[model samples]
Target: MSAGLLVAVLLASALLEGSGWAGGVGDGNLRLSVTVNGRADSDVRPPEVRVGTWVVKRYRLLNVSEADLHRVRVLDPGAPAGSVRCPAVLPAAEEAECTARFRAVAGRHVHPVRAEGDVPALRTRLTATARAGYAGVAGALGLTEEVVVATPGTGGGGASAIVTYTVTNRGNLPLYTVRVEDPGLALAPGAPDCGGRGGTVAVLAPDTSAFCRTTVRLRPGTYRSAGRASGSDRATTLGTGGERVTAPVLTAGASAVFVVREAPVAPVPRTPAPGAPAAGSSAGAAGASAGAGAAPAPGAPGALARTDTGTGTGTGTGTDAAGRPAAPAAPGAGAAPGAVPPGAVPPGAVPPSSVSPGAVPPAPPPGLRRAAGVDDEGFLGRVRRRGREAAEFGVATTLLLLLIPAAVAAALLGSRRK
Candidate 1:
């Protein structure tokens, strides 16, 4: 029944059912629903059509039952006039979509068409609201559930939605096939359950207040849901509920949601004093030079003048300008670019021969040099284009060697048909 019919039935159910809950109890209190709408019956102009013209029809079906629907069917009336197939049925309360294709030939006319189908005793009706050239019509099943209910949930990291359903037998009648129909949750490839069906999961029982759980990628908002329960004898919607969802939770390792968030680092500001020397330098003061009376600079400035500036490598005992070990000198680091010959050392400075040897690096493989002036992108592109050209040539050759000649021979032997 469509929503309109459902409302009418509900208003008069008490009379027909012989008291509410006394008669008219269906499959679990859930019944499947179907709806269609779009450019079918509009009166802007007469339905216009062309030769070999094609028309696309869109349809959506919502299970609207707590139990997942299996093998639902939708029959379109415009069919025999040349129609395609019906999309599969959605699970209980869940919805499935299907499209039908039709051809309209120009200068041709069609009579008003209508469609109908039967789900056992439940009957569905479809009628043309628009023609080939006009807008379409809208339709749906009418089953008014007195009590409106909704439930929403959330998940993250590809976790299944944990939904719990309570099926209680408030009345004396025994509920036979108590089940749940779940709409799929949005999930990405990397999620834990990505490879499996997050669409519909079924759990059936006769227990009072049964629980149903589903893990969907967590979204933040409210979700609307309705359910139907019944015995094996019939199909009717019984009860419905709603739920809400929230954001993902982050934790540690693969087993749980945990990522250790380190505290942010802060910059250390320098002191803004007049003449205070910088910290972290060797602790010393600038005193007078050994000569007569060289005024000593203050603090650290005085310390540098007193330190050795040269190596000692003269004769058997090499000597530097400051008379320190030759190994201590690093004049090349301070030398102007190109000031010294390649491999030449400053006076008393240690040469490469004097340094301690470590491991020698292996030589380059035989053909490991960069291709001269050959940019990687340009080279790769050319190679790819050459391969494509070769492929084209091969195809051309094969066609000339096989297909074309065969086609020519076939043509020579033509007129045998017709």
Candidate 2:
């Protein structure tokens, strides 16, 4: 009977050890642990991540109970579907591994991973939390420049131009202490009003723009100008322990041409005097007035000179009917002839000098003189014209020499035939 009892005790101990119930009634338990970016959740400090970057999460599910687990699954609510993968079955005293991925967001984030499984006599569930801190430190800047030109009107003033600088934050972070500058252009007093901040922008948000404007007076000419913008990322400055980190200076350029022309002057009208002969009247009235011994009106036909038909006692004006001053009387002839002779001077002969000294000479005929600055040719134009003439002359000379050879050959052939 004692031997049988010892055999039974050994058999019971083997059964308990095989069933994993030796420590007591084996309980169904699942323990879940998570690691973020290779850092365990039990670490003193959370994992660090940059905003907009991918975070790798590793999950480990261990079945510590004596009962085998079935239909085992791991899940993270924040992660997308199919991002976490693991085996469906877990045996007693066995561990399973899973992986999940998610994008890090701004600020602190709490990620919870849970494991669930079904046992023969009990259901098991476990939860774990992984914390991460994300920082946004990347920044980008953009700049653009525009110019508007205004010309002077009839009212006299210099040409004016308005220049505008547009500063843009192109990154995912806020930019601080934004400044814009233009070295090639002089700004007006109290100029560069960037949102009334005078060329400075306190804060510029992502994907937004700010405008800076200044006015300048310019002469008539062409202008080329460029603008530069610079700013620092707020998060980057703080993350780097107060070490200032600035974005690359952005540059934009624009060119424009301006011309200010002088205004034209208007002419004043002239009023005729009272009781004067009307302009463009018939010549018969002028002759009748002269026959009546009345002096012709100024600016009337045949009003320049007059001669009397009475006896010649040198009482008549020494002028001909055609209004030309008479030539000197012939030798032995009277001082003033009775009637002035016609056809006195040959054709093309120059008349006697009638203009006094210090009198301004009459302007040359339009057909004989060219107006100043009208159809004028520059030095280059003259050079091109002379070159063309020389080319033509050379071509003519070559043609003449070729014709001479042909003519001589023809003449020689004719002589031989004769």
Candidate 3:
């Protein structure tokens, strides 16, 4: 029962439960209680509801007598019309209950309820009170909040960015099943298990908070992230954050390239005809001089050498065993002047016994002049000059050709003397 009804019952029992009614007897007393809307009718402070609300009151009667009660009846005549229910017969030592309700009008009012019955040689009357009023209930439910956001962690190029959100419930009531969200940060397969993502919080009491961390993979471009908290309401904005991404760089080292072009070729020196002057000899000097006269002598600076191969006896002299001319031998390389090792001939002569009587020595090839040292280019130069002159004179300019030849011959004879 309501506090009002319980209070009303206690008050009625304290006031009238012990009063003796007839014949000095203590066994036939009446006890009564009254309540309104399950609350004690005698409560000093009853909960007030607006007008037109029903005010239901109930009255209970206990016989408390030695013998049976007859023709029992309960009444609340002080209540509004059509608002009473009384029991017709209630036995002695037994209890009975009745109820009444009235549409509350705009006023402060008090109502009295009563019970009456007859016991053997005793008559009885019981009474209680119910109070009600038309007043309004007043109170308010208000909510306020705050949010904190953590800076996002660095995400390497082509990697995921991570952000954290802390949502605080600064409301008067506890918030249940708190959740967090980020519009720009999509939920990913590998999002961290950091408390508030897809998870729930049992309670976020007033002035308390929770954290939600999320990780997402981002492509190579600048992006923005916005954070918020949600539960019973749509969503309260926590804060906003940002993330950026970039690409990679590569480099190559040294390299090479090639180009092609033709180069001028130096004229190769031609071998002199066999009769051309020995290299570095006066014939080459004379030829060189004939072009300008008074040329420097044989063996002059810058003269090139001609190589020679012989020992007078063309067969065994400078020939190797296979009969090829041996490379020019240095001095002191063969047997000493007069000391023949074996099967050797002396230099400068052939034994008459080995020669046929009428046989003539073979003439040396045309340009094969002997010299201590030779000039290959000088010999070539002399041959070139003779050719140029012969071309110039032919048989008509014989004197010019004759003079140059005679001059070259003289120079050759002079070089032989030296």
Candidate with the greatest lDDT versus the true structure = 2
Off by over 4 Å in 3: 1-28, 120-418
Worst 10 residues of 3 by lDDT: 238-247
Q: Over all chains combined, what TM-score does candidate 1 have? A: 0.19
Model 3 C-alpha lDDT versus the unseen true structure:
0.49
* lDDT sort, best first: 2, 3, 1
Clashing residue pairs in all predictions, respectively, total 74, 0, 17
Could you tell me every candidate's TM-score relative to the true structure?
Answer: 0.19, 0.39, 0.25
| Candidate 1 clash figure, as a count | 74
Report the error of model 2 at residue 141, Å.
5.7
Candidate 3 to truth, TM:
0.25
The Cα error of candidate 1 at residue 408, in Å, is 99
Candidate number that wins on lDDT, 2 or 3: 2
Residue 140's lDDT in candidate 2: 68
lDDT of each: 0.36, 0.62, 0.49
